[model samples]
Structure formats: structure tokens, C-alpha cells
Target: MDGVLVHEERAIPGAAEFIAALRRHERPFLVLTNNSIFTPRDLRARLHAAGLDIPQESIWTSALATAKFLSEQRPEGTAYVIGEAGLTTALHDVGYVMTTRDPEYVVLGETRTYSFEAITKAIQLIESGARFIATNPDPTGPSPSGSLPATGSVAALITKATGVEPYFVGKPNPLMMRTALNRIEAHSETTVMIGDRMDTDVLSGLEAGLRSILVLTGSTAPGQVERFPFRPTRVVDSIADVVPLVTELAEGDADGA
Candidate 1:
């Protein structure tokens, strides 16, 4: 949602209108993000501040996904977590106890301020036999100054210390995409993923057997498309271009009705 629907906290051209169209048509949709620091409620507030009216419940975050994965695989397990409210709250919601003693998993996630002490504890926990997991594979995230080290970079540090590779639970992983689809009860055959990154969004959508559309408002550029082995089903200038298509589809649905 950050890049596709809103870029740098501002609604990209036509993004708000497109979302309104979705609501008018009664189309189910979700705003997705790999950043696991903020809860869905926080994300909804952020989007609202940016002039994008996505609901709190419509936000699907990596923190939520990781929590779901843990609950299904190892219910009520203890975890040593290094992240912010989003990750911690989700784990708690799923009945995961946050602990540093004999944890079943050491979960890594994105945060504005990553504490060295927490990272050290994570490394120590993994060394002591806790399975390692990460929220996303993004090594760096954009900031007002420049790039800042994210979960993946910190996860690398833990791996180097403990010799244990962390399993990532976010975008570019088809499991993440499948969970998002399942949350909305949307069929991959009929759903189309709109994203800006080729590596994360496009690749994951393609892998999930969903149609993918690449928008230029975020990370990927038109020149970079040929560099990737796979391509999105469609490419558009921005969400602005998608508005018309959505209107047409809605009209067609009405006509059929």
C-alpha cells in the first residue's frame, strides 16, 4: 500500500479514487505491506492521513502472516521477538508468549530503531536452539536520509552469529501471498495483484498463480522489466491508469446483473 496506493505518505495519483471505486463496486480488496513494525490499526491511520481510506481490517501485514504461520504450525509456542508493536501484538493475539528463555522461535521483524541488545539476544536464542524466522527479506528500507538496514540485514547478522538461516515469511514468498488471498477469500484465478516491485510483488503474485500488474509509482522502472526473468501480466503508468479499467469492470458487472 505504501508504494502502490500511496507513495512516501501521499496518495499516488488516482489511488484514492480507485479505492473508492472498489468500495462502490463492493469489491473485496486488501492493502499489503512487508513492514511488520506497525499493526493494521496503525497502518489504517497512516493511510488515512495520506488521503487513502483503506480500512484497518483491509490491511494485511507480514506480522499478521507470521503470527498465523506460528499458530498453525506450533500453537501457543514461546518466541523471542525483535520488532515493534505490529509483530509483538500479532504474536500475542495468537497466544504466543514473548520470552527470552528456551523459546521455540526467534522472530525478526522491521523496526525504525533496531536495538543492538535485542539483536544480540536473538542471536543468543538462536544459538541456544530456537528456530529462526524473519518477517521479510528486504535488506534495506527507504528513509528521509537514505537507505536504512532492515529486518533482512539484521537477520543476516543473527545468521552469521548462530550459523542458522532464518525462514522469511513475507513477500516474494508465495505463502505470504496465499495467506493474503485466503484472508479475503479471493480466488487467484480471478484476482489481480497490483504492485510496484518486480522481485517482491510481481514474482510473488506470479508464483501464487494470480494475474499481476506493475505500476511505476514505486520501486520498479520500465527499463528494469527486461532484466527480470518473469514479467507482470500488465504494466501501467500508475494507479491513475487503473481507475478507468476498474470503472469499466464495475459497469460490466452491473450490466450483467
Candidate 2:
């Protein structure tokens, strides 16, 4: 329920009701987000503000997965970040030394205060043999007002300046999905990815061998699906429809029993 969960500061219509229904049924689900701006705690608070009473552990952000990956790859390296506080903090928590001058790795994510100077610094670092890493390659993110350019835009600028592509660590890349699934203890076959965007959310699920459900309430429109190469297993008008579908599936299984 990416876009259907929260559009900017406000929760989408029926989102809270749907989540309440999930809680009522004791069904397991998580808010798996590719946005790296918020930590789990921050996300939990935001959801609470939006009237979605979800636990912190149920909120997984790409920043957390990126930090986990970096910790395993390079335990102690200076990182030059071009992201929000959450991404920076996640890297620091994973034993990485955050630095701007002469860094070992150049990590890029979303930053509201982006500048050409910052992009230039990232390019110089990348050109100086520093490993370039990106949290996610999402080109745009949804807001209540409209869509805004996301981390991928920054990554593109850096790539254009440095002539090198950064390694992406978020959805459509499988690592983030694997981490979330591992944390939830859910098998690929039993899990379904519900999100608004087709390129990241749906494609990521398909790549991870899980079922994908696209909702029309986010970045993707119903008409665009027919032209897309990777089709989701199912499509719905909104996340509100998901609970009923699951109920139907459960009832069918009961009838079979």
C-alpha cells in the first residue's frame, strides 16, 4: 500500500479501515517502503499521525536495508551522503564514518536541499575512486500536491558528472525485498507486494518470485499496465480492496477443506 497508504501528510481513503481490518483478522502485513527518508520509528510516528496504528517493526524503509548492506560490505568506511537525516543516521549506526572530504564511498539518496555544489562534490568523489551507492532508483515520488523528483534524479546528476553508475540498494533490486521477507519470516509464495508504482514495487516482487498487486491510486494508472513489460499478478482500484480479496482467498481455502 505505497501510495494508497499515505499521500503526503494525509492517509488515503479507507487505508486506516483496511489496516484495522488486517489487525482484526490477525493477518500479517508490513509497510515496505522504498523511500529512505524516514527511520522505522519516524515512520511509525508518521503513520500514527495519519491514523494508522502500526507497530515500528512492521515498518521497513530502504534506508535500513541499505545500511545493513553497507555494514556487511564495508564495515568501516567514510561515506559522503546526499540524503536526509534518516539515511545519514542509518549509515552512521552501521559503523560507517560519515564524511564529506575524501570519502571512501559516495552514498546518494533524497535530499530536499539539493545543490549543484553537492552534486559536484559527489562527482569528484566518484571520480576519485570512491564507490558510488544509491538507496533507490525511483525517478519520482508522490506528494499530496503532485509528483516530485526523487533520489534517482540526484543519482542521474552524479552519473552524468562522473560517468559512472551507482549501485542501487532498494526495490527492483531484490536486496531490500529479501531483507523485509527475512524479517517477517514470510515465504515468497505466501507474500504479496502491494504498492502504487509498477516499476519498483511490482517489478521488485516479480523479481523476488512473489505475487505483485498494483493499485490505481498511486503513480500508475490502469491504462499504463497494458503497455508495461512486467505485468503484476493482480490489479486493484486501491489498497482497500486487498482485504476483501484475501478474505475471499481464505474462504475458498476453507471450502476446499
Candidate 3:
């Protein structure tokens, strides 16, 4: 969502039009983001502010995926979380109890301010037999000044201290894409994952048996595509280029119907 639709707070050129095309075509779509700092409602508002009229339910975050994974793995589980409202809210909705006393898991996620005390507590909890989970494997996140240390970086610190690596539930896992497809009741064969990064977005989509389109509006550059061992199904200059594809696909679907 960050790179594909909006870069920071500003909407990418034709992002709104692309979303409109999807809606016009009645496409099942969701804005997937590895950032667990904000809830879907929060993200929806952010998108609306950027002139994209995406619904709240159409936004999926790593926080939501982690919560779903935990609920499925162990219902009504307990966790010691070190994140903001997004992670906490998702867990709460999934009947997860948050605590510091011998919790079943130590969940890490994205937050602007990483508390040293909280990290210490998470490390101690994992040492005491609690499993470790993280929302995403992103080592750093974008900021106005520069890159800020994210969940993966903090998870590394805990792993070094406790010798227990966390199970990340976000992109590049392929499970992330599968679960997202499940959420929308969409088939992988028909789904197209349009994203800006080859490493996370494209790789996860490819692994999940979905076609991927890489856009250059974010982290990846045109020349950098060959550096990766794998490639996206297609590489476009930006989301603007995909608008016509959406129309073309929708027309084909109608014709087939």
C-alpha cells in the first residue's frame, strides 16, 4: 500500500483511477501492507486523505495476518506484545489475551518508538518457553528523515539474546499471500499481485501461485530487476500503466461470461 498506491502520504499518479477501475469492474482487491503500526480503519483514513476511496475492509495489514495466524494456531492465546494499537487491536478482535506473565507467545511488530524495556521483557519471555512471532520481516521502515529500525531488526536482537528466531507472518513468507487470498475468497490463479518490491511483494505472490506486476513508484528501480534471481510476471513504470490492464481484463471476463 505504501509504495504501490501511495508514497508516504501522497497518492501515486493514477492510483485513485486504478482503484476506481477495480471497483467499476467489481474486482476483489485489498491493499496489503507489512506495516503493523496502523489498523485497517486507520489506513483507510490515510488512503482517503490521499484521495483513494478504498473501504476499511479492503485494507489488510501484517497485524491482521499475525492475529489470524495466532487464532488459527491456538485460539484464545496469550501474548506479550511490543507494538501499537494496530497489533493490539487485531489480537483483541481474535480473542487473544495480552499479558506479561508467562504468555504463550512474544509478539513483535512495528512502532515508531521502540522501548528498550519492552524488548528486554520480550527476550525474557521467549527465554521462559514462550514462542516468538513477528508481524513482518522488514528490517527497516521509511521515515521523513531516513530509515527507522523495524520489527525484523528488533526480532534479530531478541533472537541473538534468546537463540529463538521469530516466525514472521508477513510478505516473502507466501503464507501471507495465501492468507490474504483466503481473506478475499480469491483464487490464486486469477489474482494479480501488483506491488513495488520484488523481494517481498513479487516473491510472495510468485510463491503463492499468483501473477505479479512490479511498479517502479517505490523501492525497486528498473535496472535493479535483473539483480534478483526471480522476476515479476511484468514490470511497469507505475500503477498508471496498470489501469488499462484492469479494464482489459474486466472486458475479457465479461466477454467470457
Give the top-scoring candidate (lDDT): 3
lDDT of 1 by residue, 98-121 (tens): 998899999999989899899888
My TM-score estimates for the predictions, one after another, are 0.96, 0.93, 0.98
Question: What pairs collide in candidate 3?
Answer: none
- lDDT tens digits, residue span 53-157, model 3: 999888989999999999999999999999999999999999999999999999999998999999999988998999999999998889889899999999999
Clash counts for the predictions, in order: 0, 0, 0
Q: lDDT of model 3 at residue 183? A: 83
Off by over 4 Å in 1: 254-257
Local accuracy of candidate 2 as per-residue lDDT tens digits, 1-257:
46879777678887888887777666677788878887778889988998888898898787888899999887877898888877988988888888877888898887667778888888988998999999999888777677788889889888887889999999888889989898889899878888888888888999999998898988888888888888999899987888787777667666994
RMSD of each candidate? 1.4, 1.8, 1.0
Pick the winner on lDDT between candidates 1 and 3. Answer: 3
Q: Give the C-alpha miss distance for residue 69 in model 1, angstroms.
A: 0.4
Q: Which candidate gets the maximum TM-score versus the true structure? A: 3
Which ten contiguous residues of candidate 3 have the minimum total lDDT? 174-183
Global fold similarity of model 1 (TM-score): 0.96
